[model samples]
Target: MTGTPEQVDYQQLAAEIMERCEVLGRISADPDHLVRVHLTAEHKIAANQVEEWMKRAGLQTWTDAAGNVCGRNEFGRGSAPALLLGSHIDTVPDAGKYDGPLGVLLAIAVAELINNSGSGLDVPLELVAFSDEEGTRFGNGLSGSYALAGAFEPAWWDYTDADGITFRQAAIDYGLDPDKVNEAARRADELVGYLEAHIEQGPLLEDADLALGVVSSIATGTRHTVTITGQAGHAGGTPYDRRHDALVGASELVVGIEQICSTGGTIGTVGRLQVYPGGVNVIPGRVEFSLDLRAETSPQREAALAEIEAAAAEIAGHRGLGWEIEQFYTSHETACAPWLQGAIAAGIRATGQSEAPMIWSRAGHDGMAIDKITDIAMLFIRCAGGISHAPQESVTVEDVALALEAYEEAVRRSAAAAVAR
Candidate 1:
C-alpha cells in the first residue's frame, strides 16, 4: 500500500471501476434494462453496495439523511474542511450504466489510490454517491445534492412519482425522516470545494480527439409543461377549417418552439406529449407537452423562452384554444470556479496533455445543486459518440484510465491550492 502516483496501476483501477459499474448496473427495477430510481429498493441496494466499497477504500462511510452514500477520509486532520468528490448514483429509465455511477466509482478509486499511496492531503476528502440526480421516479432531480447544499424545498415533499407515491412517503419507506433531511446540509465553511469527474456525455471530447476536458460552465436549463384545450369531436365530423383541435394547436407551437429556439441558438425539445380522448377517430380536446430548453447563458435561454411563449399565445388565439404554461424547474448557468478550473487543467496536463480542452456542459448534474454550497468544477472523460442516458452509451478503458489519472491529479492540485490559500 505504498507507492507514488507514478506507481499506481491506472489500467487495473479503470478495469475495476468498470466492473463495479456493471455490478451496480444489474441492481435495477427492470431486469431487461437498467432502471434504478431514487428511494426504491434498487436504489437502496446500490447505496449499500457503494457504502461497502467506500469502507473498503479506507473511508468512514454512512448514508446521509437524504439517502446519499457518503464516505470521509480525514487523513487524521480532525475537523478540517474537506474537498468533496462525487456524483449521482441514480439512473434514467433504460439508462446506460456509466452516466452517474462511473463518476462515483472513479472518486472511490481515487480515494483508494491516495490511501494506498500512504500520502495524505492537507484537506480531508469526502466522497458522496448522491441518491438522486436523474429524478427518474419523482421528476424532481438533484434532490439529494440539493439537501446537502441546504436548498431542499419543502414543496418537493408533495411531488409524486408515476405510481402516485409522494416523495415524503418514499423517503420514509427509504428509512429517511422527511423532517430531518435538512441534516444533510453541509456548511459552506466546512467544504474546500467540490469536484466531479463525469463522462463528456457529448461528442465534443471525442470529436476533439482528447481523453479529458475541463468544464467551463454548466448550461442554463429550464423546463415547462404546456397545456392546450380545445373542442373534441368525431374526427370525421370535425371539418379542417372549423375544427379547434388542441393537438393541432399544440403541434404548431411545438414547431414554433423548434424554429425560434434554433434561430436563437438555444436547444429545445418537446420530449413528452399527451392527447386527451386519445381515440384515433377523436379530434383531441386537450394536449399537454413538456418543453426542455437550454442555452449557454440566461439571457439566451430567456430570449428563446419568451419567443416560444409568444408563439404559443399566437397559436392558441388563432386556433381558438386555451393555452397555459407552467414552469417546473430551472438551473441557471453555473460557471466553474476559476481557481478550481486551473487545478483541473493542471490535472489534465498531468495526463500528458500539453493543453487541456475546455468545454461547456449542456446536461445538468449534481454540481448544479452543490454549487449552492461551494465552488465546483468538473473533469470530463471522452465517451464514444457523445451519447449517454441510453444503452448505446459507451466509453473506452484507455480514456477512463486517463480520466482516473487526471482526476486524481486534479484532487492533488486542488489540495495544494487550498494549502496555499
Candidate 2:
C-alpha cells in the first residue's frame, strides 16, 4: 500500500529536521557552547528526545545498554532481520548542529513518512542514533557502533575523560548498567545490512554541482606521536653546523611529510607540536608532534608512512638527535558493499540525475567500526562549502530534501534486494 513519491511531504520533513536539530543543539553540556560528549547529561537528554520521536514514528524504541537510541518497525514480522539506518549523535566541543544528528533524524523522518503514507516496507527497518562517535570524552571514537558490532574492548572501561571520570563510572552516572553493556552487541544474523545518510563534509559534490553522492569507501590510515630529542644549549653558543636543534629537525620532518603526502594520493597532517625548555635565548632541546596519515587503501598509506619514517630517521641522524615514533591508532579502509552501492546509485538516478557521483570519505565515520561486522553503505549529502566539525558547517533545506528523497528510495531498493535474495 505504498504511496507515490509525490505523496511524500519532503518540505515539511525538511522543516522538522531543521527544527529538531535546533532543539538538540540547545541540549549541550555547555550552556554557552555546543559540546555533548558520551555518557553526559546532554547525551542522555538528546537520546531521550530521539527516543520520543522514534516512538511517535510508530516504532518500538529503546536505549541500548551502550546508550544508543534505537527504534524498529517490524511491520508485522516480529524479530525479523532488518535494514539498519543511522549515524552518531554525540558532537565535538563547539560543534555544528548537523554532522551526526542529520542522518539519524533523516532515518526517523523516512520512517514517519512511510507510516503516514499508508505504505509499508517489504523488509523490517531499524534506526539507531549512536551515542558516542566523536570520542570527545574518552579518546575512543565509535564506542556505540563498536559495541553494536560486538567489538567493544574491555580495556576501555578504565579509560578516563578530561574530568577524570572513568568510562564505566560515566556510564553508571548516566543511568545505564555498565554490567549489561555486553548485551548491546548485536549478532551477525540480526541485520541485513546498514545504511547511513550523512553530509558530504567536503567540497566534492558542491564543486561538481550535485546535491548528493554515493560513498565508495572510507579512508584508512595510521596515527602517531613523534618525538625528536637533542641537546639544549644557549642560543648564542649553538653553532649552525655543530648544534643539535630538535625544533629544526622537527620542522624539517614536517616539510618532508608534506612532500611525501603531496605525491597526490595521501593526506598527511602535523596537527600538534610542542617544544621543551621554552625560552627566548635557549635552543629547543626536545620536540614532539602528531601525525595523521591517510589514504584510500592500506598499502598506499603504509607506503607513505614508510617513506616518512625513513626520512625522519635520516634527518634525526644527520642532526645528531635521538628520535622515536609511537604509533597510536590505525584503521583499514572500508569499501561499500557492491549490492548496496547499486541500490544507492539507483536511488540517485530516481531524482532526475542520470549520473550519480561517487566519492571517498576522507573523514572517519561510524561506518569504519560497523563495517567490521556488517556490510555498510553511506550517502553523502552536499554541504554549502564542504566545511564540517565547525560552527559554520551547514546544509540547505533543498539539499536535505534531495537527500531524503534519495535516502528513502535507497531504503526501498535495499528492501527489494533483500526480498529477492
Candidate 3:
C-alpha cells in the first residue's frame, strides 16, 4: 500500500498464511477435526494452542481481563498508532475451520510478511485472538470485545453457565485476574483502527462469482420472549369457545407474528417455544415463546418488534388471558467507513475484480459490536455453499490466498496511513 518496487513478497506471504492455517487445524483437530473451541473444558486446550501458536510465530502475546489475546509486532519506540487485526478463535459447539481462525492466522501472516520485508515501513501492528467473541458461553456474544469497549454488563459476571460456573471463576481458571476484568476495556482513544477477516456466512459471494466481498453494514437485532397465560381444563370437558387455551393463543400469535414481520419486509422467527404441562388431552394453561427480529437498521427492527408485541397483546386480550414480554438482547447496525471501504475496493481491484459490492452481514458477529464502538471493519471471503457454524464449513486454499492479498493490502494501507500522519 505504501512502499514502491518489491518490498513485499506475495508468494511467500500467501504460503505463510496457509501454513499457519494448517498448523492451527492440526493442533485443534478433535472429533472429525471440526476445530471447535467452545468456552467449556476445551477452552483451556484451545487457548493454550492459540498462545503456543502465537509464540511459534515469533510474536509477543498477552491476555486481557476479558481473555482477549493480543500479539504485537513492535518495530520502534516511537509509539506509532497500530493496525489492530483480529477475530475470535472460540466457536460454537461444532464449527467449520475458517470462521474465526482465518482472520487471526492471516493477521499473523501479514505481520510475518512485513517483518520479512527489508523496507522502511515500521508502523506497529497488533493481532488479536479474542476470547468469548462467539458468546457460546452464557449466551453472550462479543464477550471479549464488549468488555474491551467498556460495554460489558455487571450481570454478565453473575451469569452461571449450564454447569453453574460463574464468569469470574472461568476468568480465573483461564489464567486471568478476575479482579482486573474492568481494566481491560479500551480508554476511548488507544486504538487507531481495527480490521477483521471472516467468511461471508452465506452463499452470495460464491453464487455471484466473486473473490471476496467487503462488508457495508451489519444488521441490528432484538430477541424477546413472549408468555401467555390462560385457564386450563380437560379438553373433552371444555368447549372450544369456553376454553382459554394458552396453546391456541400462542399458536395464533405465532402466525400473526410471522405475518407481521414478513409483511413488513423484516426478518423474524419463533426461534423457541414451550407449552406448560404439554399434553394432548389437556387445554394449555401457559405458553412461553421467543421472537427473534432483525433489520437493516435499528428503527426498522424496533418497529417490527412493536408490531409483534401488539399482535401478542391483542391475542392475549381477545382470549381474556394474561401476557408479558421481556427483552433478551438488542444490538444495532455498524456502518463501514467510506474511505476504508474505498481502500478495500482498491485492494479488490488489485485482485482483478471489476466490482465488489458492499454486502450486509445477516448473522451476529463480534464485528457488529466492535464496529459500533470502535473503528473496525470486516472482509467476507466466500464459504463453500455459504454454510457456517456447521461441520461442513469450508473455504478454498485459493480463496484463502486471494483473501490474504486483499487483507494484507488493506492492512498495509491503513498502517502506512498511520505512519504517514
Candidate 4:
C-alpha cells in the first residue's frame, strides 16, 4: 500500500475529486441549482459527507462548534503542530461545483496519498471544510474561518437570513450552541500554516496556458448597502421639475460608482438593487442597492469609496433625496507569507514548470480571515474561461491531475520547511 508522488494515480485521484464535487453539488438547498448556505439543513448534510471523506482519508474527524468540518492526521506525532489545509464548503446560490468543494476534496486526496505512502511527515496534517465563506445567508462571509481564527464578531449573532431567522437561532437549529462558537477558535501557536487550492476564477492562467499558479496576495474587499429615499407620487401626475425620484438618484450614483472606481483603478460592483412602490404608474420613492468594492490596498479602496460617497451626496442633494450608506462587511488585503509562497513555488516546479507563475487574487477567500491566526498561501487551478460562481465553471481533468500533483508536493515541501524551522 506504499505510495509516493510518482506512484500516485493522479488521473484516478482527479476523477474522484471531480466526482466528489459533483456529489456535493447535488446536496444543495435548491433542487434545480447548487445553493448550500451556512448552518442550513443542506450544510449539515454536506458536513457529514465531508466528515465521511475525511475518515476515509485516515484522519480523526470532528465538526467544530462553529460547524466547521475538521479532520487531522497526526501521523503518530501527537501534540505536534500541524499543517492546515482546507477551503470553505458553503457556496453562493447556483454556484459552480468546484469553487469551494474542489479544494476540500483535493486536500483529502493529498492526505490519502500521504497516508498510503507510509512516509510519515515531521508535522501532522489538518483538513477543514469551513461551513461558511460565501455569506450567502447572513451577508457576512467567512464566519467559519473567522471563528477558527478567533475573529468571530459578536454582532453576527443578530444577522438574519432571508427567512428572518437570526444566526443564533439558525445555529441552534443546526445543533450548535451559539454561545460555544468561540470553542472553535484555534490558537496561533498550535499550527504551522494554511494552504488552499482553488480554481483561478479568472482568465489569466488559461490565457497563459498554465495549469496552476501561486497567489501572491488577496485583494481587500468592502461591502455596503446604500439607500436613497424620496417622495412617491403618480409618475404621470408629477412634473419633471417637481419630481425627486429616488431611483434616478440611485442610478446616477451607481454610474458614478463605476466611473470613479474604474478611473481609480479599483473594482466596484452593484450586484443587487431594489426599488419600492412597484407599479408602472408609480414613481420609485425609495431605492436600495449593494456595493461591493475591492482593490489591492486599503488606500486605493478608501480613495475610491470616498469619491463614491461624495458622488452619492451630490446626487442626493441635486435630486432632493435623502441617502444613507452602511458598511456590512470588510476583509483586509493579505499577502502570502514568503516562506509558504516558496513552498508553493517548489510544489509548482515539481509539476514540471521551470518557473512558477505568481498572481494576485481579486476575489476574497477564507484565507483573508485565517491570515489573522497564521500564514496562508493558495494554489490556483485554471478553469475554463475563468468562469466561477456559476454553473458554467469548469476545469479539465488534465489540469486537476496536475493540480493534485502540485498540491501534494506543496504539502510535502511545507512539512519539510516546518521541520527545518
Candidate 5:
C-alpha cells in the first residue's frame, strides 16, 4: 500500500478491517454477549489494543484522560491544526461488530497507508477512538467527544450506571483522573475539521445498489417518557362506560403516533411500555411508555412531536385519565460542511461511484457532538439488510473495499480543504 491515492490495496485493507473487528469482538464483558460499556475493563482492553495498532501505524498514540485512544500523524508541523478523523469505539449491549469499531479500524488502516507510502498529506491527521459513544454504561452518549470538545458537563460526574457506580468513580477505576478530565478537551483552533467513515446502518445504499454515499445531515430526535394514570378497579366489576383504563388511553396514543408518522419522512416508535401491577385480572391503574420521534430536520420533528402530544392529551382526556410527558433526550439536526461534502463526493467519485447519492443519517453519531467544535462530515458504507446493533449486522467485503479507497481519498481531500482555508 503506497501513499499515492491510486496505490491503495483495497482488498488487503478490507481483510484487515474484518480481522481486527473479529479480534475486538472477542473482548466483551459477557462471554455469551458483546457488551463493552464505558469505562469498563472490557472497554479498556479494547481501547488499549487499538492504541497499540495506532502506534504500529507510525503515529504517536496515547490513551486520553477521557479514556479515548488517540493517535496523531503530526508530520512535524508544530502548532498547525490537524484534521480529526475517527469514530466511537464503544458499543451498545449485544451490538454488532462493525458499528463503532469499524470506523476506528478503518482510520488506523488509512494512517498506516499514509505513513508506509512514504508520502503524507500537507496537514496533520489525528485519529481518535472515542471511549464512550453508546452511553450504555452511564446513559449519556458522546462522553468522549464531549470531553474533547470542552463541553463536558460537571454534573455528569454524579451520573451512575446500572450497578450503582458513579461516572467519576468509573473513570478513576479506568485509570483516568476525573478531576482532570477536562484535559481531554481539544481547543477549537487546534482542529481543522472532522471526518468519520461508518456503516450506513440502513438499507438505502444497498437498496440503491451503491457501495458508498456522503451524508447530507443527521436527523434531529426527541425522546419522551409518558405516563397515563387512571383509577384502578377489578377487571370484572368495572363497567365499560365507568372504566377509566390507562392502558386503553395509552393504546390510543400509540396508534395516533403511528398514524401521524406514517405520512412523512418522520419516524415514531414506542419502544417500551409498562402497565402498573402487570396484573391479568385488574384494570390498569397507570401506564408508562417511551416515545422516540425523529425527522430529517428539527422543525419537522418538533411539529410531529407536537401533533403526537396533542393526540395523547386528547386520548387521555377522552378516557378520563391524567397524562404526563417528560422529554429526557433531544438532539438537533447536524449538517455536514459544504466543502467537506464536496470532498466526500470527490472521494466517492474517485472510487468509481460517479453518481454518489447524498443520504441523511437517521441514527445519531459522534459527528453530532464534534459538530459543536468544528465542521464535520461523514461517509457511509453500505451494510447488509440495514441491520445494526444486533448479531446479524454485516457488510460485504466488496463494500468495505470501496469504502477504504473512498475514505483514503477523502482524507487527502480534507487535508487540501484545510490548507485552502
Candidate 6:
C-alpha cells in the first residue's frame, strides 16, 4: 500500500462522472431512453455515454460480443496478468443516482490515474463497464459480468424480456451478434482479480457514521414462483364452510413469509401477486404469486424457503386447494478474498478512519456473479437513512471521495499483486 502513492485529482474525476450521470435525462422505464422496456436504442445511449467518458480520459473502446465495454492502457507490457475492475451499467426501473454508475466511473478514474503515471508500474490495467446487471429488460441480472467470467451459458440466449423480445434478439438489436456470444467471454486464466464499489444499499454504515466498508461477502438469494387454485363461487358464497377462495389463501401465504423472516437478518418477500379473472364478486378461482428469500448462508436461505413452501402447501391442503411451484433462480454465497480485504483496510487506514473495517453485502452484485468464476472483492459506501433504489437515494460527497481514494489504492494493490506473477 506504499510506493510513492499513485496520485490523481480524484475530486475532478468524480465530479465528471456524477455530472455525466446527472445529464442522462430521467433514465427511467422509457423505451427510447431505455426505461424498463429495452428499445435497443438504450444501449447505444449508454454505450455512447460510457464511450464519451473514457474517450475524454484518452482511452479507446474495446467492446465485445456481449456488449461489455473494455478500456485498456498498455504501459509497455511486462509479463503481468491484467488487473480487472468492473461494475454494470444497467439499472432497475426508474433507478436512482449512484447504484451502478459510481463503480463504472471509479474504474475509469482508476484508469485515468494509471494512464498518467510516469512510474510505469509493472502491471497493465483494464477498466470494464458491464451491461445489463439490473435485469430490467431480460429479468435476469449480470449478463455482461457473466460473459466476462465465462459464466454466461448459451441457453440464456432464449430468455425473453417483458415485451416478448428474446435475449438473442436484444443482443442483435444492441449491435452484438448472437452467434458470437461465446467469443465475447474472457479466458478465466487471463483475469487476475476483480473489484467493485457500490452504495451499501442498507443503513449499516450510515447509522454507524462510517466512511466506507470493505465488503466481506455478497449475500445469496432464492426466488420462487408459486400458484394456488381453489373453487370459485359467489363472494357471498353458497355457504362459508363450502366456499374455497384462492385470494384468501394467498393472503395467508404472504403473512407466512413475513413470519419466517421476523428473526431479523433473514429476509423474505411476496412482492408480486395476481388473481385470475378479476372481479370483486368472484371467489377467485386462481392466484399466482412470487417468493423472495435472502440469507448469509445457504442452509439458512434453504430453510427459510422450505418453511414458506411448506406453509403454502399446508394451507392449500387444509382449504382443499391445489398449488404449483417453479424456482426462478438462486445465488450462491460469494466471499471476498482475504488478501484483497486486507489491502482495502490498508486503503481505509490511509484515509485516516479507525472503526473496524465493516464488511457485509445483502444486495446482489456483479461481483457475486464474477465470484462464481474468479477471485473477487468489493467496497461499500453508506447510503443515507438506510434507503436505496429511489431518487432520494444518496451518499455524502465526502464519503464518495474517501471511497475513490480507497478503491484507487485497492486497484493499485490488486495490480501490484497481478504483476508479481
The CA-based lDDT of model 3 is what? 0.75
Residue range 1-421, candidate 4, lDDT tens digits: 1257566778888888888988999998889999999999999999999999999989999999999999999999898889999999999998999998999999998999999888867899999999999889998889999999999998999999999999999999999998999999999988899999999889999899899999999999899999999989999999999999999999999999989988888999999999998787899999999999999899999999899989989998888999998997787899999889998898889889776899989899999999998899999999999999999999988888999999989999998898898
Candidate 5 lDDT, tens digit per residue, 158-248? 9999889999999998888999988999988999999999999999999999999999999899889999999889999989999999998
How high is each candidate's TM-score?
0.96, 0.96, 0.89, 0.95, 0.98, 0.92
lDDT of 6 by residue, 69-119 (tens): 787665777544666787777766656767887788877766666566555
Better of 2 and 4 by TM-score: 2
Candidate 2, poorest ten consecutive residues by summed lDDT: 1-10
Candidates' RMSD to native: 1.6, 1.8, 3.3, 1.8, 1.3, 2.9
The whole-model lDDT of each prediction reads: 0.92, 0.89, 0.75, 0.92, 0.90, 0.75
lDDT at 174, model 2? 90
Q: How many collisions per candidate?
A: 1, 1, 1, 0, 1, 4
Candidate whose TM-score is highest: 5
Q: Quote the positional error of residue 151 for candidate 1 in Å.
A: 1.6
Clashing pairs in 1: 202-386
TM-score result, candidate 6: 0.92
The digit string of per-residue lDDT tens for model 1 on 300-350 reads 999898888898889989889999989988889999998999999998998
Clashes by residue pair, model 3 = 202-386
Clashing pairs in 5: 3-117
Candidate 2, residues 249-281, lDDT tens digits: the string is 999999999999999599999999999997879
The per-residue C-alpha lDDT of model 4 at residue 9 equals 79
Give the poorly placed runs of model 1, Cα more than 4 Å off.
1-3
